[model samples]
Target chain A: MKVSAIITLKKDVLDPQGKVIHQALDGMGFENINEVRQGKYFEIDVNENDPSKAKAIVEDMCKKLLANLVIENFKIIGTQ
Target chain B: MKSSVITFPGSNCDRDMDVALKKFGFNNKMVWHDDNELPKSDLVVLPGGFSYGDYLRCGSMASKSRIMQSVIDFAKSGGLIMGICNGFQILVETGLVPGVLLRNKYLEFICKNVFVKLDNKENAYFKNINKDILEFHIAHNEGNYFCTKDQLKEIEDNNQIAIYYCNSEGKIQDQYNPNGSIKNIAGIFNKKKNVLGMMPHPERMIDQSLSGEDGSIFFKNLINNIK
Candidate 1:
């Protein structure tokens, strides 16, 4: 099973990288850009056959290692 | 007194800390991150550096290294543990201390000396220190401290805040906050005051010719406090 997780900074947390990226986008003449929030995406291949089990395992990983609850949030997209 | 400094693969400041500790009359040992057992000591330090290359998140990977379990255990047993610079990132990641260090507010890696005001004098780290303000060196990209509101309240209530970024006059204002830390916090102690984590590197300031003597004062006071 392939599990995917996405991590993003919390709303109130300051994302400096995101801010700089937004600035670069603005300089490139891309208009109508409200904001740019950079995040992390990961795809993990697990031996489990059940998608739900794989997702649960990956969610645990997020809680412990992949995501720091103080500043980042992690969501597991449906396993493939 | 005896002290141990843990050196991770990317820990560049471990030797400096070893030097500082030894200079202040401590029997200091260099402990590798892969070692399971920590040598008995009065103090253990997680020194500054780009540990684990700051991958995934700063200090995230190093927090789970082989030797960290012993470090955590030592801290739980009320042994003194101090983390400086990148070590501070690892401390927070280990949950030995509260809050996390984010990137600098301006998206820059800051490297400079800044004065810090002592918040509480009751702890072993700062007790009996003559100066209320000391100049220390700071170098890090992710030193902007952040925490939930409830955690902040708890931290404040417990007098866990150890130091604040300040000017020479010890005025803690927005202008002196180099990395946008909350309440200008430069260092904080755990609830029990046995564990300390901070962005400033006192080891870097141990010598007047090299940098400053504030760190010498800090280390001397620390070892005396332990004794």
Candidate 2:
């Protein structure tokens, strides 16, 4: 099974890279942008045959390694 | 005294740390990350470097290296452990130390000599040190320390803050904060005070001619404290 997850910084944590990207976009004539926050995406292929099992495995990886729970949140977006 | 310095694949400062420890009279052993056991020692150091090529996150991959389990055990046993720069990042990733080092506020790599004030001197790493403020070298891209409000409160309540970025006069202010770390925190210790994680590299400042002697002072005092 294949599972995808997104890891984002907590709301209160500063995202300077995202802010810089937003500024760059603004300089490029983009408008109506409220804010920008950068995040990480991971695609994992688990050995499990079931989607739920794959998601659970990825969730475990997120908690243990992929996402630093202190500053980041992880969401398993898809399992196939 | 005996000391061990763990060398992860991408660790560049392991040799420097070994040199510094040896110069200070420690029988320093270089331990590989793949090793399953730590050497008998009074001190264990995670030296600064771009471990695992800074993949996924700085220090994230290295934190899971085999030797870390032994390092964690050593810390749990109240043995002294110190992590410098990337080593500090590894400590946070291992959850042996609280909080995380975020990307620099300006998203630029910082490399320079900055002053740091010892916040608490009751621990083996800093106890009986002669100076309250010392100039140390800091070079990292992700040294901006951050923690949740609750964790901050707990760290403060326990006096876990070990040092703060400050000026030569020991004035701690936002202006002197090099990396935008909260409260200008430059270093921290675990509740037991045996585990220390800091962004500054004392090994870089060990020699007066090459750099400065503040690190020499630190090493000399550290070995004595251990004894």
Candidate 3:
């Protein structure tokens, strides 16, 4: 099974890196850019076929390693 | 007392902390960041430096190192842990210590010896140190300590405010609040008071009139309390 995890800063948290990128894009004359929010994507290969088990494992990984629950949020998607 | 200083790739103050601990008759060792096992020591010191090149936010990468798991485990078992400057950032990143360290509001690297008034003398780390002004050096860009209003109040009410930046008169001046740290807090302790993380470099001020010796008392008091 293949799983993809997308992690992003929580809505209320400040994203300094994203802001810097937004500024750079503006400097480059890309006027259409309104805001830029940065996120991390991870692709994982899990041997388990059960969607519930896979979701549980991904959630554990996010809680323990992939995301900082204090300031970030994460979502996991997989082929059921 | 037995102490070990964890050295990351970019840590420049490991030797200084080792020397300070040795001067206080401590059996000190330098543990590498990649090592998962901690030395059999009473205390663990994460000294300051640009760990992981200060990339991905200060201390963010270093917190994910292999050694942090063991450090976190040791801390959970009630062992003493102290993180200074970059180390403090690492502590926050690892979630071993509460709160976050943001970039200096002025966005400039601050390097100077500043006065910190000891707000809590009951901890082992501050026992011998007077509940008054002590000078220590701080050099970092991401040293501003921040927390939510309610969390700040909870920390203050719990006596976790270990040290506060102050002026020559030992008063916390609003304008002189270096780094825009909330409550002018320079250091804080975990709920159990066993873990301490501060931005000031106590190891740099161990020698009086030389390195500005007021900081040495921190080590002395910690060792004495452990014994």
Q: Which stretches in model 2 have alpha-carbon errors above 4 Å?
A: none
Mark the 10 consecutive residues where model 2 chain B has the least summed lDDT: B200-209
Tens digits of lDDT, candidate 2, B1-227: 99999999999999999999999999999999999999898999999999999999899999999999999999999999999999999999999999999999889999999999998999899989999999999999999999999999999999999999999999999999998999999999999999999999999999888999999999999999999
Between prediction 1 and prediction 3, which has the larger TM-score? 1
Two-way lDDT contest, 1 vs 3, winner: 1
Against the unseen true structure, what C-alpha lDDT does each candidate score?
0.94, 0.95, 0.85
Q: Candidate 1, after superposition: displacement of residue B179 in Å? A: 1.0
Candidate 1 TM-score on chain B: 0.99
Instruction: Name the runs in model 1 displaced over 4 angstroms.
Output: none
- List candidate 3 stretches off by more than 4 Å: A1-62, A74-80
lDDT tens digits by residue: candidate 3, A1-80: 77888888777555566878888999999889878988888887888998778888988988876776666788996655
Worst 10 residues of 3 chain A by lDDT: A9-18
TM-score, chain B, model 3, is 0.96
Best by DockQ: 2
For B1-227, candidate 3 gives per-residue lDDT tens digits of: 88989999899999988999999889999999999799898999999999989875688888989999999999999999999998998998888778888777666789998998888877778876654888889998888888766778889789999889998779988776888887898999998888999999988888876887776777777788999
Cα error, candidate 2, residue B86 (Å): 0.3
- Score chain A of model 2 by TM-score against the reference chain A: 0.97
Candidate 1, residues B1-227, lDDT tens digits: the string is 88999999899999999989999999999999999999998999999999989999999999999999999999999999999999999999999999999989987899999999999999889999999999999999999989999999999999999999999999999999998889999899999999999999999998888899999999999999999
The residue pairs found clashing in candidate 2 are none
DockQ (C-alpha based) per candidate is: 0.94, 0.96, 0.18
